[model samples]
Target: MIKLGILFGGRSGEHEVSLVSATAMIHAADKTRYRIVPIGITKKGDWLLYDGPVEKIADGSWEAYALDCLQKDPARYSIAILGTGGRSLKDTADFIIPAVHGPYCEDGKLQGLLDMADIPYAGSGVTGSATAMDKIIAKAIFKDAGLPVGPYVPVMAEEFRRDYPAVKARIEAQLTYPVFVKPANMGSSVGISKVNDGSTLEAALEEAARHDRRIIVEQGIDGIEVETSVLGNYGDLQVSCVGQISYTADFYDYEAKYQNEDGLTLTIPADLPEEITAEMSRIAKEAFLALDCCGYARADFFLEKGTNKLYLNELNTLPGCTGVSMFPLLWKHSGLDFTQLVERIVELGYERYSITHRG
Candidate 1:
């Protein structure tokens, strides 16, 4: 049986959410075909091995679920999983299913560590992961690819601190009222604010700086949230069922995502006309290929409710995988179960590794 180290949790704002996603993978992954090794990273960046269950990770009850099995030290963060096999973490794991999301883990940092350890792991490589994490860089590439994105400007921390009025004036000149101020490198709607006018620009910039050194201030997208799933290598791609996100909490904020639960309405196989769905899916695949994304990525869009004018929002290098998350739900709606979904991710990880190792 193939041994898979399911890595989750990290120093990300979505740390709790990662546990939730990993649990769904644990429940759905076929145990008969693989040996499941549950590894979790603490808030302090310590990695621990657990034999109990993946549910604790999902429910954010990790310590409570594996209280007895908790290790005193976390020196075992690094793993020797591939060259030999998945028998022992110190020796081998056929492949790694990194259910990690957000800054510290999904932004290529974890991928770099895994590459150093010489382990085959799922998701995008270091470059693709890093690029997708930065909203400014991602948008620039999208524009270069001829994809539609709203007008915006990226502000560097140095510029913002060195001369506040100059930076603020530059933003006021380029973007209009009702703009979005966001951290260039963070995700899960963290450190993002929508400014309705100039009065809020400075405060918003200061808030965004707390999360990332660079920030992107864009024209607030006025539309409904539409998301699509892109899978396979850059050249060969497919899109999953389209979905819509309706927020009751202003924007798709942290509470709207996890805390409030009913703060948003997620409509599956979004009730868009067939033509619109086809268009969004096509744009998604195009965006995926343009960036040479591999394995899987979720491309989100903003559609003007009546006109259906689509504006590419951003691509999530590591989209959410929780039971209630969109990625798995889309696959499930497309006839692939949650377990099969994760299996494919692991297989793709190995496939990508084989391609890299051949050179």
Candidate 2:
């Protein structure tokens, strides 16, 4: 059996969410073909080898049973697990699935580490992860690729703090009311706010700045929010069915994503014209390649209500992996179940590893 490593619960605001996604993956992964090794990274950035019940991993009680498993020695390629006789060595995982989200892990930090060790991992690499994590950079890449994107203004934390009035004035002058203020590098809508007018703009910017040094304010589009999942290496890509999220919250926020179970509604194969769906698929693939993303990504789009104009929102290299999450649901409708999808992701990871490491 292939030794499959599942890395989750990273140093991110979405740590708890990562636990849930990793739990779902562990439960759904094929046992006959793979042996699962659960590695839990605590909020404090401690890496531990967990050999507890999968359920405990979700609730986070697994930390009590985890063995400190940091690789302090560069010569040791395999993980060092603590056993009764002291520390024992375990073979390097044949393939590692990084289920971590947000900053420390998703923003290329962890991917860079894995690359240094020459390890195979599922999902995007350093460049793709870094670019996709920053909204401003991704928007520039999308715009350069000739993809349609909404207008947005980026402000550095220092710039906003030094002269709040100037930055606020710039935002007000460039974008109209009802703009989205968000941290440039956060995901799962962790630090995002919808400002209706100038009165609440500064506070919204402050809230976003709390999470990231760089913030982006985008002109709100009156459109339907739709997402499509893309998979595979650069040349050969697979685009999944479009999924629409209907949420009652101000927008798709952190609470709507992980908490408040019924706060949002996700419809697979979103009710859109054949042409629109095709366009979303086309753009999704284009965005995936444009961002240099490999393995998998979920491309969100804003379909203008009246004009039917499609605007690229952002690309998430490591989207949520729960069975019911939009990414998996979109793929499920596209003919791959949860188990098969995970297997396919691991396969793609291997494929990417081969191509990238080829000497």
Candidate 3:
């Protein structure tokens, strides 16, 4: 049996969400096939083995039961992978499932550490994860691939603070109202705002800047928010059924996404013309390979209502996975349940690791 370390929770905005994903994953891994080691990361970012019964996954209840947390016994805890890496139980781990999302954990920071430790892990490598994390960079890559992408302007925090008016003016000139102001390095819509006018734009920019040094203001597309999940290593990949997200609000911000669902509706296997679905899957696969992403990625896009134009949004190397998240949901729609999905990812990670680390 493979000793699998399920890494979850971290110093990311989606930390609470990670807890939910991790809990679901732990419950799903086949006990007879794999021995599981549950590793949790505190909001402050400390990695440790949490000792507690799994209950209703809380968004933010136990930060890291420091005092009650399990003490690292060499025999039980295993070595720390010898370097900064996914602190998986090095005793064995044929594979590691990183149920972590957002910055510090998903942005290749943790992936790089894992790479150096010589441990196999699910999802993209350092470069791929970092590239996918920054919307500005990822969008640029998509555009260069000749994929139709919406126009976006990047505003550095330093630049935004130095001359707010000039930056705002440039944005106003290039994009119309109803643009999305977002932190370049965030996920789960934690620091995103849809601005309609200069007043909202200013607040949006300021709010976005608080999350990251770089901000991205993307031109809005009049379409439904549909997303597809891509899986594989480099050349060989598959795109799952497309799903449409309907937010109660004009946009699917954090509130509508996790907290409140007043205006949130999820349509699995989105009812689209066969051709459109084919096209979305094709473009999504191309984008995934274009970025050299391995294992899995959630390709988000905009399907403008009347015009029928599809604009590729950036790909998420490590997407949200809180059971209710789009990645697992889309795959579930594609016939891979949460358990199979986790197992598949771990297998993919091992397969990729064998080839790449085979030197």
Candidate 4:
């Protein structure tokens, strides 16, 4: 059986979300075909080889058990990700599936390590992952590719700190009130705030700065939010049916996404004119190819309420895989079940690796 490593938990604001995603993936993964090797990374960046029941993963009880095992039997439970020989991550698993999200896990750091170790892993490579993670960079790339993106202004944290008034004025000049202030490199809606007016802009910018040195202030779109999933490598891609998100919050904040589930409703095969769905699928594939993404990604879009003008929002190279995440649901609606979806992702990883490593 192939030793499949499922990496979960990360040094990111989305750490808890990763745990939930990992748990779902572990449960869905076929046990007979692959030897599941669960690897947990703590908030402080400690890597532990966990062998506890999968049920303990989602609620975070597995961490304590893994830590105890590590202390009692360091050689067996400890993980030397970069170390040589049998204990290293490269030697432990033939293929790795990163069930983690956000910064360190999905921003290309872990992918880079895997590349260096010559290990095949699911998801995009360094350039695609890093570019998709940074909103500023991704928007620039999209605009360059002739894709319509919502108006946004990038801010440097140092510049804002040096002269708050000047920075605020610049933002005000470019965007009206009710702009969204967000860390350029964050997911799960962490460190994001909707500023209705100047009175609250400073606090929003400051909060964003705490998460990343780069910040983005975007013109709030009064539109319906839609998303589509893309799978497979370049030239042989599969775009799933579109999905829509309806929420009661001011925006689809972290609370609406994961917590306060009552406030949100997800509609697969989003109700839309056939032409609009086709256009969205076309744009999503273009954006995925523009970033040189492989394996899979979810592209988010905004459809203006009145004009029906569509703007490509952002592509999540490593979108959430939890029970409620749009990426998996979109595929499920497209006819692939949870197990089949993950199995396809692993096949794509190995396929990409083999083609790239060919002499």
Best by TM-score: 4
Model 2 TM: 0.93
TM-score of each: 0.92, 0.93, 0.93, 0.98
Q: Per-residue CA lDDT of candidate 4, range 33-85, in tens?
A: 99999999999998889999999999999999999998999888766787687
- The residue-by-residue lDDT of candidate 3 on 174-278, one tens digit each, is 999889999999998888998888888888888998889889999988899999999899888988999989876768888788777656789998988988889
Q: How accurate is candidate 3 locally (lDDT)?
A: 0.83
Each model's backbone clash number: 7, 0, 3, 0
> What is the C-alpha local distance difference test score of each model?
0.81, 0.87, 0.83, 0.93
Cα RMSD, each candidate: 2.7, 3.6, 2.4, 0.9
Model 4 lDDT-worst window of ten = 77-86
Off by over 4 Å in 3: 56-66, 71-89
User: Per-residue lDDT tens digits of candidate 1, residues 160-223?
Assistant: 8899889889988988888989999888788889898878788889988988889999887778
Candidate 2, residues 58-123, lDDT tens digits: the string is 888877666422334323323453222223322546578988899999999988888876778999
User: In candidate 2, how many Å is residue 4 off?
Assistant: 0.5
**Which portions of model 1 miss their true places by more than 4 Å?**
59-92
